[model samples]
Target: MLTTDSNKATEIRQAAAKHHGLPLLPRPTDDERDPLRWPRSLKLAALIATAFVNFTANFAGAGLSVASPVLQAQFHKTPNQVNSLLTFNFLLLGVGNLFWVPLGVKFGKRASLLISTLILFAVLVWTAKETAFAGLLAARCLSGFASAAGESIVPSIVTDIFFLHEHAAMMSWYTILVSSATAIGPLVASFIVQYSRGGWVDYVWVCAALAGANTVAIYFLYPESNFNRPKEPLHRVSVTGEDADKVQVVKTETISRHRVSVVSKSWFSIWTSVFTINREINILEVALRPLKMLLRPSVLLATFIYGTSLASQIILIFAFPSLLLAPPYLFSSSQVGLMQIAAIIGFSIGCFAGGYIADIITAVVIRRQTGNVYPEQRLVALIPGCLVAPAGCILIAFACSDKLHWVAIAFGFGMVSFGTIYAPNIAITYVVECYPRVVAECLVAINVFKNLVAFLFLYTAVDWVASSGWTQVYMIMFMLVSLSMLLAIPFYFFGPKWRGQVDISNVSEE
Candidate 1:
């Protein structure tokens, strides 16, 4: 065995094993197979593939919102009935993760992702071809289920491959893809509905084509990121000369013994293994883990903060077609589609502002505190999002009620879109950092609550605005969203302490 002076070893570890003065979390080992130790090129490729699938998933789900008018005319249905397609889809998008995430935990993320992508492709095609309204609704529901893996598993893959310090920047890219897809989906669908002879069918087929391509890409390009390395014991080092009488034990965050591979498994064998379930993992417990995580104060707070931000965007998507398609606006499908450009710009700016900029600010805060880093430090970034999003909602209400220029409504949409990316990026990064071990389940809980919140608002938003008037309904939403975002203040101060109160060791370790 190799040996060094205890003090010298500690110094070396401290100097070499830190990022921005913070210790490397879930510390990496020497094993080549460890994702932390993977090459930069490989890591980037995985991230790209993951982001692509995420975009395709959200694109498929939200793109249809732009086609609601066409669908209503084709099926002779009311706007509320047309809106149900998205409402029920959002509901299952959340609840479906309860099923898919457990499979990811028991099998592997690659398997779960591949399986879901295939299902998504099939459902998208079914949606394109379905003639009846009820049939299309069924296809939409299945598409939501297929999309769940894309939302929940991508975060786990991010955590598996990247260290804590890299999460904010990386998650920013992920969130930008997701948010941009939501905006761009409608943009693309609008053009298709206006220009393409196939109309709404072409939009669904576009998503289907992307999903099919992503499935093939995943089969070859994506590697299984799930690796369960056993924990290592403390490294004990001896002293020399005058300090020989004293010994010091240095604790590591996590360490693993390296093993040489005598045989390399075939790609076919590796692919086949993804479906093999590890019997040691309790399927039932894994399935129910998200529900238990929902009870944690940190998780609950993060969910509401993230959920409300997302709901703001969903409300805009649901309302835009009706608002812009009628009255002084009388916008064409293509013009309405152009509206998403504002949201895309907002998402792009928010990604950099909240993601890369936040990481830099976090480093500054860590340095000021002499290398101490807390998850709460990230919460500071949510402030701008909280203030801006509700303000945007208020702007939209006024713009619509007063019949202002369409540019005002677009600008308001941009502001709301900014909040969707900015606040949720921090909220998600914070919660995942707080519960790093249970990332898969934590994300499941977050997505479930987020989607449920969107579903409840969307299910009632059309009727509410019809009954209560746009000004009153949106004012209430603005207040609710503002109150939800404000909760971050208390969480920033007490979140760390409250996180300690919840024990996830049993579920995470298992």
Candidate 2:
């Protein structure tokens, strides 16, 4: 086993000999240590794989929008049929989280990340060879399922590796990879479809490269975080009657469960001890945790923000190519792709700003409260974006029909992209902080619900946004944003109350 720099080799030694009767295992030698240093190497490791995952997943999902017209002609299908591709992508993407999240916990997180990337590699290869539209849709759906594990577990990995002081910052950086990739997705897809002689083959190539690079980097550079390792074993001692008052010598039983997994394998499991409702829980209760988690307040708020904010993107995916290609713009698929660059740029800035800003705001709140920080404090940063998102949405709505400088419309859409990621990032950080015990489950449910919202909107968003016009749609976005802020207001004030409830409810493990 490679233990990074923690003298993990020493810990494994102590653990094996601690009367646990676990088999001794070989450890990595000096040559295997990570030689790369710093915010530079660490940032590269954290951002690069995440970016690759985002790039691949986004291409698989939204790349087709640029080629919708051709796909329709080739398949002899309707607009709605083309729309199913997006709907199908979102449908399984939401639910896929449930299966992968538990696996992430059961296996080590490192293994889960590697497993998903490998699956993605195979799926994309399959995608490139398919001619039938139905086959392509199925490939995309499977890709979404494979991608969900990466999306659900990434925040957890960030939280685990980085210190509490750095959690929001790192989380935000990762969020940028997501939000920017999303905003930029169709733009890249459009151009690829326009230029490639093989038509959509280019999309597959892009994902293939991204996934391949990420797989290589993760296998080499990514370390198993300290939080992921089993807990320190409990030390047991014995006493002599003559020295009853004095400490005794005895064997220690570590919290590290006996490698009930003595034999290494692709998949592994062990009995996990959990406390639920102050009752000692078996593996069954913990397994069932994701089912009930959707009902929690933090989760619902996360879902609302996630679902509502992402609906805006789905609208663009369905509408943008049609809007730009039909009008006075009359651009090629490549030009339409270039149009998305504005939104991508805006979203990139917004994602990075939101990540660091949310962290800073939460830090300030934490310090003011004397180390007793409320997770809702992160929500405070989202309120402004909530208000701004609608305004931007309305602008895009009006510009879409009015047919302004075209640049104006792009700017409006860009603002909407920025506004969307701003709050969602904070919402993500806050929700996880609020429910750290079920981080993977909470994210899976949030993504699942959010994906449902996207699925619903993708199938119908074109009609909804166009029927309502940019103006009416924007107004509706405004209302939702207001609702989010109003909902969040309580969080700022009563966040401490909920945190207290959670703290009070948690019994000491001893």
Candidate 3:
């Protein structure tokens, strides 16, 4: 039988080890032993929240073409100058994750979310009041910064709340919300601007209004999902002091004992029943994680593959309408916005189902690979999308090259929308699944790299399309899209093996 004193000593040593940060894995508990499935209501709520957040974040980016002139007229700037708002948003959104993700570990997901959501609301409200060009720019920059906290950690939130099986589809739904907003936000912005003499300001104010409304809704419904409880030592022992030697060991045990004692001693709980201690200072490590993730080979390669593709996607959305509508095409701005409906229809359902398809591929791959689910499983979803996007680019390119039937152009656009949305959804799912612990890191790095590329291409996209005509510009698109698809195979096949090679921190803690 274990004596009371030896049992207490064992407990002390275990606590010390945890404080020193040498955790093996998240221990399974009766509460957590609940089968790895989400409650139906909770799952639906998460999906809805993710979709809503995505839509709001993308509200302006989706229809910048329509909003561009309103901005140009108000600020007396060129199209490139107008598009800079998004460039700022992307930079802040990418880097803000670095700041907010750490909060998830220290304060838990709900509190972190509340803080971010509130800040987003306040910034948007303040943005609505800015009238001068510089004022508007400053407001937007801060709004973008405030918005980052929510956007950066959402994938982590999804992972925290949902199980493995639901991830692909849930992520897809989130993507759908994002893509749809891009497809629809401008359409809405255009109509709103047309009616309101205030024009571009109306669009910003409306978005601000929406953000404010969402803040209240989020606070009540969001659940705590840190999942990790404060660890306490509960070591098993014999009545004799035999295990005493284990705790007394100079090198390892000494380190462990000091750590646990420090943390345990520092812990001052409101009640003995408290199972969580706030580790506030360690938060800086969390904030800088996404920056460190770029050093990882998997994140770097995957970011290149996915980031460039996304940059192209954004460039197409922002630049293509003006190219097609402005002179010889002679289509009105409204007609251009209408053209997006074809793409929007495809992007919405295409994204939702793409997740299910990714899940299916992962399941099939798992069965074939001795019941193991690999990061590569997520890549299979890209296969069809990858091939389809290039083909769409070819058809669209050829059609634009010839100024062929508008119907031909629309058909190709439909395919492009479907293919583009699907492939990235796959990439997002793969990254989240592969680096579940450091998910916040991978997500933000990809966005930063993606947006940086987007900022660069956006500058040249107008000039390139203007000088070369749509067909040649699209030929480049076909090549880029085709290459992206072809590259998916080896990554999906070889990526799994590599994902296993990296040491992801905090999975053991989760």
Candidate 4:
């Protein structure tokens, strides 16, 4: 009996060691035993708050576009100069990622969100009230900075609060909210400008009101999600006299320890939580880590893929209005805004196709491969989008060159929108799965590269298309999109091998 007992003890220790030492995998805590025990109502509320934040911020970004003509008249600037508002906004949006994610990682996600939302509300007010062109431009720059939390910080919150099986689906919902704003903002802006005596400022007022309401909701509903997982192994001997021989590691009550209970906190306590600062942050390290992510091969590849897709989207946003408003199409401002409805539908399709399908692929691949889910599993979903997106570009080019019916152009736009959401969603999901330790930093790097590329292309997009005509410019864009998509072929084939080279054991403590 003693010899058998000794052997059993050895086996248990080995099992514990196996779990504790795996760096790529999250350390198993009580939270893993029953993942469904997370507070359903609070989780739903939090998810809604984050989604609203994403919508409000993105709405502000797109809202300015429909009013470009009015802006040009008021500011006495050329079309190019007017578009620079977005240039500044996109540039800072990327740069702001570096700042905001680190703040969330250090200070706390809820606190960072509240602060960012307040800043966004203030900037929108300033944008609405400012009469000078320079003041308006400055407000836009600041608004981009303020709104960075939605893109960089909110996704991390999603990852922090949800399970692996849930990440893709939840992310899809988040993306839907963000993408809908592009279409919805223009609709709101066009109608508000059309009817309101307040004119262009009415759009800003609406955004500000939505943002202010969201800010209040976040303050009351959003709780901190950055719970530090206990390092101790969960398979310890039970202290109960009746169950001395048994291990009770999977109890739902034990899992509750991993969450911070705030249902009972008073108003003052909730308000004061925002002022709490984390002392563990090394400012220099936080600033440099995202830049360092660029050196990782997998990260770099993902960056390029996401960046190319983003640049294409920005190009389409700027170019489509100019194209439709001129010559054969002659679409009104309201009509052009309505055109985004097709893209909105496409994005909705892409979100469901790419996001949930990704989770299914991971499960299928893992089942096929002896129940092991590799990082490369995420790459399979990219192929469908990769092939389809460029086809959309081709369709758009031909339709524009020949002046086909508006529906042809709309269909092409839909395809591009679908691919944009589908491919980038897979890329980001793969990165997080592969490098769970440094998600915040890796995302910051991705955002930086994506925004920089967007700014460069957007600044010159109008001029290039005007000079070369729609067909030629779009053909060139098609080639660029194709090349970026082709780059993924290598990643799909060799991604597992490349991920194997990464020492995920040296994971970020943050």
List all candidate RMSDs to the true structure: 6.2, 11.9, 11.8, 7.9
Query: Model 4 — which ten-residue stretch has the worst lDDT?
Result: 232-241
Clash pairs for candidate 4: none
Among all windows of 10 consecutive residues in model 1, the one with the lowest summed lDDT is: 254-263
Tell me the tens digit of each residue's lDDT in model 3 across 219-292. 54444545543342322121222343232211223333232111111112211221233564366666666776
Return the lDDT, model 1, position 360: 62
lDDT, candidate 4, 1-510, per-residue tens: 999866654454444322221111232344532212346576777788877887887788877787788888888999999998878887887888888887887787787788898999999999989999888889999998988887866666667666555567677777677766766787678777767889779888888999899889988877766655443221222121333233221222232233333333334644556644657666567767788777776778778777777676667777777888888999888888888888888888889888877766654444344334556667776765677778888898889778899999889888888877787777787777766667778888988888887788888988988888778877877887788778777887787676654332234421
Weakest ten-residue segment in model 2 by summed lDDT? 267-276
Estimated TM-score per prediction? 0.87, 0.78, 0.78, 0.84
- lDDT, candidate 1, 117-153, per-residue tens: 9999999988988999999899989998888887888
Candidate 3, which ten residues in sequence have the lowest lDDT sum? 261-270
Candidate with more favorable, higher lDDT: 3 or 4? 4
- What is candidate 4's local distance difference test score? 0.72
Give the local distance difference test score of model 2: 0.64
Each candidate's clash count: 0, 5, 3, 0
- Model 2, 1-510: lDDT tens digits are 345524554464455443222221111112222111123445456555654565567656777778888788888988778878777876787778777776666655556677788888888888888888889889888988887776777877665544344556677666666666665667777767877787767777777777777776666655543132222222222222333222222222432332222222111111121111212333354455666677677778878887887777558757877788886888788887887787777677677667766665654554344334446667766744565677777777778768887888878778777766787778888877676556777787788888887687677876776667767766776677657657888877876565443321221111
Report the alpha-carbon TM-score of model 2 versus the true structure. 0.78
Query: Which of candidates 1 and 4 is the stronger one according to lDDT?
Result: 1
